[model samples]
Target: MTTTTRGTMHPRFDEILTPEAIAFVAKLDSAFAGRRAELLQTRRDRARRISAGENLDFRSDTRHIRADASWSVAAPGPGLRDRRCELISPATRSMGVHALTSGAQVWIADLEDATAPSWENVISAQVNLYDAVRGRLDETREDGSTITAEDSPTTIVVRPRGMHLCEKHISIDSRPISASLLDFGLYFFHNAQALIDGGRGPYFYLPKIESHEEARLWNDIFVMAQEELGIRRGTIRATVLVETITAAFEMDEILYELREHAAGLNAGRWDYIFSYIRTFAHRGDEFVLPDRDHITMTTPFMRAYTQLLVSTCHQRGAYAIGGPAAANPTRQDDEHRHRALALVRAEKEREAAEGFDGSWVAHPAVVQTCQEAYATVLGDNTCQRDFRHGPITAQDLVSLEGVPQTITLGGVRTNVSVALRYLASWVEGTGAVAIENLMEDAATVEISRAQLWQWLHHGSQLAEGPTVTRALLDRVIEEEMAVLTRNAPPERARHFEQARDVLTQTALGDYLPGFFTPYAYVRYLIDRPLRMDGPLSPDDLRQSEQVATPVTNGSAA
Candidate 1:
């Protein structure tokens, strides 16, 4: 296929969408687009097999890879040893500045779930990240003064959209390109050498990988990218999130696949839970999960997952990073703030004590607590890779037999409310929202909706005696919408309606869609004519209206 560098570009996108950057992205798309499509189809087939009652076990073919004791992942790259990482959306300039100055060791300049994926947002995030990489990020304060990063800034690790999402606005050969490549290619094209010059290479956090084959794909992309940019063989490093049930079973293989480029693996708790639910949604009451609130890391199943992660990473000589602490302190209430702090402290302490090298925090407030917890366990040590805690069996990993399984009316209502609010915010171009004090993102929303689907599908009996049927869910949705409509501003109320439609379709549909973004993207995020063809023809977007308008003050008008 001939490489075409022409596509619809947002007005604000011109700065980041340079001719050279466009060509580079086109090159990546031309090279890897076929593999990406095949992987996506493989995902569909795997999901079908699981739905047909096929048990998810470690692949027999890969037994040797898992059993081999001689293999280990590459050593941690620069600035990744002590990973007290904080996730921040790069779309927000002030947030980007705050993340750099917040003193966390690593800042996840997120372009995936934490972002709204608006064309404006997509370009703006790239611009912000570009500025951030060059140490040119500055935010004007209320006093008309500027705030900038200190002498020592946090290391930036970009998390592009997963393999499943597409950048519909950007096309190659009239087909939409992978969102992952668009993000990775553009960032690498512009910032790879600059990041290397600054002593840190182009680092990434690969999200939602279901198997080692996916890891191999990423590794291959890294190799091709490095070669294209004339970078050293191992200059690029990635930390894979073992967030899927299938991935949980293939940790060792995943690391082996990316050994040359792998820094470590993350225990992505929420998405892990969502994956479990989605994988077993067809299975009867046995796999029916309890409330999302009760599914803490200390729970038996969760404990098993994290323990296996720590053990697997250590055995493979990779850093074992723990999940995100999503608590955002509520300043209006002292007790609430204290409670939130206590919760974060306990969670971090648990991760540290359980032999994780480091953990993630969603807000800056928890950074110190995470650092202090790691300090207690690590002291001067970079990681606990020497700590071996498992010869854990497949039975142990999937043993949900005796875990807590109570469902409450409150839990159902919470799921509905949270999912509605989140979808509403998401469609309005806000991927992260503070819901009841917690910084909720796509993962949390996934759990909420997945749980709702599981409960309704299984006719789960709530503690209050009502079964979680579609009728019960509809009543609850109506009740929640009424309350939101009554109290919310008019613009927000409109968003609430949009959110309701999205949540209802995704949660109550006969079959769960692989992801909510694709459906919502076409409906809410794309303003142009829906062209289902090759590279978006110039004529396709010639008179296309902007799909995503700017949100003022994060409001959804």
Candidate 2:
């Protein structure tokens, strides 16, 4: 067997800097180093907003709007069929640091079902993830466009092990375990703070949020961290995963509680559906939806869940992110790709119709489909003249009537005034400006530079227009494909094969303390095909025998 040495240690930020970059670093240092008063004030303001039931309008605060709803942007419509696929890596050790850095919108560096458990592997995985994000220096390809220090896509998010034990969840016995939990969280928190301190604040996606109280717990910890470690507030927001039935009901309150440091809510479909079944399994007569995969967003429970989430978020003024379709990536054949594209197009169209501003895309290949979906719905610039600047009403949006943009189109001076201001923002960000249907003031052309600044530094909203074109779509595809195919490219494919092999041979059996399963460690009880009687406790393992190789083959059946 070949033994590979761990690569050289990651370079710290301070070690690689030119004089100007160093000076810029110094300024950023001052920004976080000496701002207790400002941090406190911001936190208090955010707390007040949460208290007032006003979730933040992230568009007005943060500089970027998430494409969380981008997944289903074109569903149930012309461009696609009603299909969504989960983007699974099919790899137990699915850490695609290179592929993720190359261009995909989000990378679920999974430590859950996609990974196996071993303390060294777990720590190595976490450390690997940290180093990948912390910045790695590699030579640019000869033909590859020179990526400046700034322009790489922000596309990695971790789905760490949940409370469940299927993956990397730590457990000494058959019971719930806190082992490695604190170490993992602390490491993540420290690096996350370092990232924020380096100016990319609050960019984490926390998964498995089952209740409002859990969200509160996270918030409390965040506040304590800010006070104790001196990380700035409003600079470390997280997107809470709404994956459980309890979390669905507590959505509003969860958003309210975590308002200050919350980026938005994420709809985690698979685990969510799984949890739903587990939670309500006892209610024989209860109207539980069919099994997880069979339940679409159109399913009554799912529809209500999604709509409620959208309504709650919009009502509280937070972004309503759609859930992942958990869609499959494109097949190797052209027919498969075409069919998948059609499905993607349809799904995205429906998501748009359902009022989601953005969604998730699992693969680099799928990003074009998602972007195109958003473009088809959001690209129409005709509504600019219709914007009504009057006190915006919920009813207008509900009926897609009397919306500020629509009401303002009647040539009301107030509407036009607000539209003009909005248009100014659009123009400043990009060279062109169009809101709803009006061509921006041609005279505002000079403000494009300033608008660019606003869009990059402050979250500015834009009404869709021609900017989302086929050319741009083709460009992103070409660029992303280059990244995906570079440097012995099918790297992820290798890992996928490894996982498939593992699953194919893995057997089903119980490693219970007193059970007769092979490979069961006497000290550690393990089981699969979970029994309804509940897991065996630590006491059960006291007299157990230690065994290994529980399953002779991957298929337990």
* C-alpha RMSD of each candidate structure in angstroms: 6.8, 21.8
Number of clashing residue pairs in every model? 6, 66
Can you write out model 1's per-residue Cα lDDT over 167-241, one digit (the tens) per residue? 777766556777888899988988999998998889999999998888888888898889988899988999998
State the local distance difference test value for candidate 1. 0.81
Q: Write candidate 2's Cα lDDT for 15-86 as tens digits.
A: 332233323322222222212223323433544453344432223221222323321111111111111222
Task: Write down the worst ten-residue block by lDDT for model 2.
Answer: 507-516
**Segments of candidate 2 deviating more than 4 angstroms:** 1-95, 98-108, 137-151, 163-186, 286-293, 380-535, 538-557
Which residue window of length 10 is worst by lDDT in model 1?
548-557
Candidates in order have lDDT scores of 0.81, 0.39
TM-score of 2: 0.50
Indicate which candidate wins on lDDT: 1
User: Which sections of candidate 1 miss by over 4 Å?
Assistant: 1-12, 88-91, 528-557
